[model samples]
Target chain A: MSFVQNFPFFSIILAMFSGIVSSVLSGKKARNLSLAMIVVTTALSAGTLAFCLKTGESYTYMMGHFPAPWGNEIRAGVLEGVTAVLFGVVMFLSVAGGMTHTAEDVEDSKLNLFYIMIDLMLSSLLALVYTNDLFTAYVFVEINTIAGCGLIMIRQKGRSMSAAIRYMIMSQLGSGLFLIGLSLLYDVTGHLLMSPAKESVELLVDSGSYRLPLLVIMAVVSVGLAIKSGLYPFHYWIPDTYGYATPTGSAVLSGLVSKGYIFLLIKIFYRVIGYENLVGAQMINVLYLFGVAGMVMGSVHAIQETDTRRMIAYSSVAQIGYIYMGIGLGTTAGMVAAVFHIFSHSATKALLFISAVGLYEVSGDRKDFVSLRGAAYRNPLAGIGFAIGALSMVGFPMLSGFISKLLFATSAFDSPSKMLPTLFVLAVSTTLNAIYFLRLVITLYSRRREGDKPLPPNPVKKSSRGLKFAIVCFIGLNLVLGMASQPIVQAITDGLAMFE
Target chain B: MDVSLVEHLLLNIEETVSIVLFGIGFTILLLHRNLIKKIMGMNIMDTATYLFLASKGYITGRAVPIVVDGIQDVSAYINPVPSGLVLTGIVVSVSTTALMLALTIRLYERYHSLDLDEILILAKEEEQI
Candidate 1:
């Protein structure tokens, strides 16, 4: 019944090993090994998920069995359980989609490194989520960030190097500010453990001499995290990076890398500034301001974007806005909604990006709007998957986005401060989201003109059996998950109850 | 506020002045467009972060955070964790800077220019077509 005792963090260990092995293998062997690894890992992840769901135990893994508030601890509680399940799902799907590319696009020299970095990224992210120690979490963050850069730079062509460099530079700035925030926290309270750090800060706040230190630390850390989360005013790097990277790389980065930051943000906010203390509500306003700004700005920019990848990149910025909005509400429902949205957004967006891989492969890599005039007619499955992702993003009924946003809006109405403005902001942003994503959907779905020059024979082979089946699997999962949102919502609500 | 000796040491005039200068250098980094010059500014900023951490460790009579004085009774020395973290951070920053420089060289080879504006123009032109 004890999932942690049963799971033994084996998925993460296996992930790292598989990544290394996959990178080393080549030709038929590499493909077969990767497939086997994906199947085995997915089964292991599912076992972990089932055990957690059944027992509903908040499991804590103490590395070296050290006492917390002094030493490190990794907790596999409800939130961690949900995250693990999401990680498992993403890994399985990405690998399935990646099988298509491996047959043709992969360079034998780079394959080993690619698989290794992917595994390392997943394993480090798993570690980051489990650990409650502030310093340890930052270490994991750095590892994941660096590994992500490695994945992007593996391409070593186009703007990938520049994209990777920019990502690296920005991440360094974020890491520096994050460290400074930690330093400032250490000065105020000579502890690295999050719970005690919160206690010490609370004690100082009551004393009143070091209030500014708390504010400074909050500002620095928030800015640093905002850079990673691609929140407004710090989103300059995301579009270019996502646009330039390989499709698989972009999918994983968007799906998982940013989630690492969001996970840490939730932890820091919960552990260091407990929900009860945050009821004073200035942080809510800040979230609302930036959330709305990112939503509106990102959506508007996406509407004008001619490049499909760049447009999707912009849409991610806006989708993250919805998550931040949920956080701003600061209720149990809001937090739960935020977590649910994270799961749903990652799934749907990864599918959308993977679909683009199919299109790009066939069309010889044209990403601009004009080039995609007859794409929907050529690849109906991809066109349909993009539409579903777009619809979910716009919060259409029965889709995953609807459930999360409805909960978020309900929570926003109950917010203690500036409720009307918050509601207005979310509503306007949703409308804008529909406007842009619908445009993409409509363009892709409409019939091609008869007079249009016959599109050239696709450069790459039409979707192979394996690739087509993978796309179908994702589309099927998206539909089923949409129909089955209630249980997921209930699980999130149960998880958030701990914070309350 | 009940002031400690450590706090008084941290409030030193000369160190504070130099910290201010370091801040100015990093601020200049945000304004400049010359990639090489901006990198130099980043190094300046990196030095400031290191100084800040080291200054926090200073106490009037404390020795360096090492066992040089004696194996036993090391509590009187400056705290070592921040210094250790900073050491790693510095290495990371150096490697990142090196990588960025390499990328800049590649960009120059492609566009035959080092100026950000020129490269951006070329990129935009490509995108337009």
Candidate 2:
């Protein structure tokens, strides 16, 4: 009845309402309005999270007062609260940092539309993370997809056009398969609300009825989301989409979009299907296989990248691998680690993208890795930000990535068979991360003079204050996430307790 | 393997057809190089999913899902849930299809080609240059 519970619905409604309102307004006004909206909503999300944590409360608000089996539901727990806060903060910071690029990268006419899509995307993401109805999840998933494509193609460049087409085709394939899975699920269970569906699913599992069809449904749904999230072999479209978009788009795509899908997968595993049922099904092995392959091969590809942005995009594929690997461990501690990695990765990647934009602008708008050589010297603030981000990504001690890796390692000890391979993959991937990330860091700080032309003064020079503040926030976020890992881990454990 | 169970499944021909449509859609999506055909494949797949959902709402002898005043017996009418879901799916699919076509237009305008392979090759060449 109070702010913590009802605000979830209000957040979504306000986002969509503002999206529509801003789409018709002038560009500058729309930008200011949307910024204000995101900031206030973010503050509210933080407030909600703090309230829930202090009260140790979780709640479910049924739509239209029909209650679960017959009505839509949205459940909020510690996990969802933290997740909403993470999504909000990263989006706010990413957009705020990339404003200069937004003004330049997107055409004037499409700016309002761009802000509209951002609002819609934020709305859909909140719903995706909160909705307890499968059909509601699916609808919001579509909204997020459409909004994501809008963000990519707003540039109207040929490369971005091709990239958008590829992205649409691939993600559509994903949603199509996802839809089919949902249809099969509904067909079998005769219910779409997660709680009822879980009841039916548990009965089926206990009775061992519809075993094969249920397994097939599980596979289809996992595969659909896997493709959407750019896991392993399905990652062909990720780089083109992230690499060619505006810097802000790349940041949002890498940091938030994939994480949203992963969050849904976590929801499906824990809430709808039940964790015990998942172990019985042996479906996590599929995730494990793809995730391992993505880690090794995705990093290898990143090492070969010529474009700086594409390199970071490829690194994302590998980071996604780590999250899936955590899922594959199929333990509560492992899931907490995975979710923690999501938070850490979002902060680090947003930092890197923002820094990369500064580097690119300093290097005369060049996106290629070669041109950015020594460009870091031209922009020291971004340079420092990127260095900190790279070190964290490489899992240096006392950084956010280190905590997640440590959690993953500790979680690995609980599952004997998973221990060795998980450790090996973790070891190898960390080294590979060092290889690519270290090389970039070295190149940034190297003494070699930037060739071909005297680079212009830092392009962010015109409005460096906000960008500088955002980068500093990134640094502080990463450090704080690393050092203050105890309470978050405890919170995650408590939140995950609600799953059972 | 009861003969009656098999017979019941066989009698449900529409779901089978939807499955077949899904197969065709996946095949087109995977094998086709033409971007438009791939988009068409995606639509076909969405249609298959919608049909699958619609069939789930079907009943052997039930009336439509329009509830009249003072109705007491619920089993007299078919399930309306899947129809509502399918309606939403159709709208989402139509909008996505529109966006895909718009992207196709932009692609064709850029590379003067409709084939995905050609676009990739050109993109790679641009990368090298």
Candidate 3:
């Protein structure tokens, strides 16, 4: 094996080891260590992506002496490489952007613990993307859950604490369902490694054996992941969890954490049960219906939300709905669209969250719509950043969101049964997105009313240079994804082809 | 409803019992108002899943998975993978339960209540204040 093939395994272990080491360091040192680790991982993953694209083949690295079905392994293909790169880049930018808020919101003594959680979170996300063993994925899923809870409640406020618990309960329920489904799948297929399991699944399907059990397993696992990803019916924990957490926590949780679960679900659909069998079982239709409902309902909820953070959180539900709807189309083109949307949404959402922090600082730390009037006048960079993010989300031309929407629309034409609803929801959801996000954009730039009482003097001295640099980089990332999406889409298509 | 279905369920009693237990635990988790009760429900659900997994690894008359008396036959012992998996599952559940309990303690200290609804109302009132 080439030395470059070891990058994925190295990245996971490095993040995990750094997490343990960061626990003992002082807060500032831990922050520096964590940032350095993320930067290194991003570089390594970029190298792996380059190697994979050049070689045009996927490779698996055995964890120990045992190989394949006998021992744990991590498989890195074009798709995993691209996902790891995107995750690493977005995670670094989110942490850098939200650093000021993290230091302010979390107590000084417990700051190291926050960085420790970030390291662990990054490790788990990479594992979720690259893991070849089903049981290993489950363990990392739990790790991701616990680390996410830690991130959410690190602010040490009553609201954040309550939100963390609610998130835990919902997350545990999802994992329980996932674990049981995995055990049942093992019982039927007698394999834990994904490739071997897929072989068994294909044989069982072809022979018409264990059909009912297979379908049930597929539904159970899909539902488990859907809940974890905050699908329409199971998103009760999202608003409080996202709104109450620190800015970094909100960005990472909303952008990377949920996407990690959905990516795992997509992997299971293609690698474990096989996509054809997934369609045959009619699970995609269920995902499709829920996706469409979430798209409309989540936006409606957002429209009614007065708090800016909560509105953004609700918009996440809508964005996740679009991804699931893409998957539910059950065509290769649809899958490609879904994967592309994952990248675009991660970049855009993280940008919005971090920029909201800047806007919040300028508005005397109030997050309500009314308090946010003329926020742009106070902080032009944040204002412009939020506007770019909002427009991208609203599918403006030459933005990442517009490209993903176009891909989804074109892909919908391939599936006759889903074509009309996909088009209808796409139209309605975009309009709804505009109603809230555009309004927020307009609110930020509008002058404060003359009749309103004069605001108290702002306590924050000035916005940090790190915050501005992070926002600028995020906007650059969004524009790149928007204006130059052809290469990324090509990469995604190649990765998915190598996936099976 | 069918007679043969009942007979089949009886034949696979361990699986049936575990499924029933899982359902009960899930229902409790969904319906329970108290924080501790919710944690207990999650634990019960986890235990039931372990039972299901353990039963899947058990054979009718196989020895425990060990090299005893130099017996090398594959069928001499039941599968050991699920047992290892169960051990991992137990460790994870213990940690999650500890975390939930820690968060519960924090909530109780802040709100002076263990009931979720009461705590939420108190929290909302606190936010307004």
Residue A424 local lDDT, model 1: 83
Q: Which candidate number would show the highest TM-score if scored against the true structure?
A: 3
Query: What is the per-residue lDDT of model 3 for residues B1-129, given as tens digits with 9 covering 90 to 100?
Result: 999999999999999999898888877777898999999999999999999999999998999988969998989999999999999999999999999999999999999899988887887788878
Q: By DockQ, is 1 or 2 better?
A: 2
Stretches of candidate 3 above 4 Å error? A459-461
lDDT of 1 by residue, A166-275 (tens): 67667766776776677677767877777678888788767876766677777777767778878876787788788877777788888888887888888787778666
Worst 10 residues of 2 chain B by lDDT: B120-129
In order of DockQ, best first, we have 3, 2, 1
Better of 1 and 3 by DockQ: 3
DockQ of each: 0.33, 0.68, 0.81
Q: What are the per-residue Cα lDDT tens digits for candidate 2 across A476-495?
A: 98998999989888888887
Model 2 agreement with the true structure over B1-129: per-residue lDDT tens digits = 999987877998789889989989988987799988897888888899888888889888998888776576888888988899989998998999899888888778778999998987886677567
Question: How would you encode candidate 3's per-residue C-alpha lDDT over A1-500 as one tens digit per residue?
Answer: 89999999999999999999998999999999999999999899998999999999898889999977899989999999999999999999999998988999999999999999999999999999999999999999999999999999899888898899999999999999999999999999999999999999999999999999999899989999998999998999999999999999999999999999999999999999999999888999999999999999999999999999999999999999999999999999999999999999999999999999999888788889888899988999999999999999999988899999999999999999889989999999999999999999999999999876555686334678888988999999999999999999999999999879
User: What level of docking quality does candidate 1 show?
Assistant: acceptable
The C-alpha lDDT values of all candidates are 0.72, 0.86, 0.93
After superposition, candidate 1 runs with Cα above 4 Å error: A1-3, A6-14, A17-57, A102-106, A279-281, A362-364, A450-454, A457-460, B1-31, B64-71, B126-129
Q: What is the TM-score (0 to 1) of candidate 1? A: 0.89
C-alpha RMSD in Å of predicted model 1 compared with the true structure: 3.6
